[model samples]
Target: MKGKNIFQEKETHKYDDIIHLPHHVSTKHPQMALSDRAAQFSPFAALTGHEDSIRETARRTEAFLELDEDKKEQLDEKMHVLQEYFSEKPEIMVTYFVPDEKKAGGAYVTHRGRIRKIDTYLRRLLFEDGTEVHMQYIFEMDGEIFGDTE
Candidate 1:
């Protein structure tokens, strides 16, 4: 609604323009209805090629990230990791295997970026390049809990 008052004896409400958010895909027109459903996923989309150890690390990260700062501090001695990426809108985010392990031929590294996604049972991250990473696996790794995985 381009801020128009549609109470002029009209049964149908008149719209002007649509304001689109990052997640919103509607290019609303003054006289049109634009609806979009573009679901975003993480840049780090799958665990298909990652080593078991590195994957485990990702899993731990996923789990700890789900916790609030207080709850995270309670469980994680290295609260700094949590603090780095914890916020209403994550100031930092988790990146898996930069430069790509397949090409780099080394352990895929996990680190924090400047943007983060909302945490949930199965959350996904959206990167600057529209890359998406799944955090749910971070909660699924079954191994000895260790210091923030790298």
Candidate 2:
């Protein structure tokens, strides 16, 4: 009585006759499992994959970079020097842009590995580990072998 409000007292009076009654068990249908009953009251996703779509849209990506003439010339010179030292299989670091498979923009990745061979037909820099970087996507190349070329 001390903790109960007047409204609560009136509400309890209305259900006094049935307050101690046993809960009804359906005779027409079998009882549901506790897990299944709990699942009915559990939180659910009405929009399904909408949250994933929103997260994917909110994700950031980098735009592909276009090198200017001066930079392009420098890169071309580096490529020439790399070819000269190709037979030596020099270890090098290459910075390149990788396009996102599901989006317009991409990301710049720097890879360090030993050069395997340059595929002229494919126009890609192949690595000893079977990694390939397309020539057009290359941003920069660096190595001890290109010290004099730079």
Maximum-TM-score candidate: 2
* Candidate 2, 65-141: lDDT as tens digits: 89999889988999998899899999999999999998999999999999999888889999999889999999999
Itemize residue pairs with steric clashes in candidate 2.
none
- Model 1 over residues 74-143: C-alpha lDDT tens digits? 3344223444444633334343433333332222345444444434445555544555555432222111
Using all chains and alpha carbons, the TM-scores for the candidates as numbered come to: 0.23, 0.78
Off by over 4 Å in 2: 1-31
Clashes of each: 10, 0
Q: Report the Cα lDDT for candidate 2.
A: 0.93
lDDT of 2 at 74: 89
Number of the predicted model whose lDDT against the real structure is largest: 2
| TM-score attained by model 1 | 0.23
